[model samples]
Target: MSPSPPLPKERRIRWGYWRSMMKIELTRQNVHNEFAKKVELISGQNLFACYQCGNCTAGCPVAFGMEVGPHQVIRYTLLGLEEEALGVNTFWLCASCLQCTSRCPKGIDIARVMDALRTVVLRKKERKDHVRIPEFPEGFLEKVPQIAFVSGFRKFLS
Candidate 1:
């Protein structure tokens, strides 16, 4: 008899999940494949190529401070876990230093992927508070050039 063909990742995960006898139900409706496709379209990077090697996370300087880290962010995006991916502080915490991107064996441009996620979240207005341009006190504002505030907001909000 021939061996069974390998299951797709989503199915394999679900199969293992059922074997574990977990009470949680897998919600197919919650996943939107278009999100992943859009990220690839905008970033021009194949994020699905990432195999969870953790190289991105290992080389990330700010990984210690990130709630989800670099690899998890990619995995979440690849799996189409939109809410879970966007809910974390990973994108906000990313320094865009490109360490993860450079070291990535797949040349996936992990930084761009994170930026794409943030852009989608911002565009959709899904999280109103994702990247707040904090209002500086009037006193501090007066001391600094107006351009400074604008530049700073442009830098961090991206």
Candidate 2:
């Protein structure tokens, strides 16, 4: 049989390959940052345990309106992209219903994580970038502090 030509070597890496590689490197670096440690400490949850199962996404009612879904938020948490995760409107939009927490196969307290992300975002003043929904019910922020104070006092008494 005639000798076949040798298979051609790939002369250039595709853009997708470079993008994926960059994303992976960024995720690795993010996971090792101080903000990630702070997030874990404040949330009292191990973000690294998540496997991106999408249960949180399925449970999120506002995820459809978010730039990043709940599952992506969890992934961002695991990747340690604290600013990106917290800066996103998704964290602010969380209803704190605990559906994500209840549905997580790994038993990750996703609701707690959302609360932690919100606290961090507020502390950093990143809420300035959050999209304002005119349809959002009034007196939302007013109720939160009262609830938090009551809860804190209850805890203190306990």
- State which candidate has the highest lDDT: 1
lDDT of 2 by residue, 1-158 (tens): 99987655443577875666674665456577777677778889988788898989888777888888877987777776666777688866777778888989998888788777766765565335443445458876456688775644332221
lDDT per residue for candidate 1 within 46-158, as digits (tens), equals 87688899999999999999997788887777667778888899987877889999999988998888778777777774445544535656577567788767745543464
Q: How close to the true structure is residue 22 of candidate 1, measured as C-alpha lDDT?
A: 57
**Model 2 score (lDDT):** 0.72
> Per-residue lDDT for 56 in model 2?
90
lDDT comparing candidate 1 with the true structure: 0.77
Considering summed lDDT, which 10 consecutive residues are worst modelled in model 1? 23-32
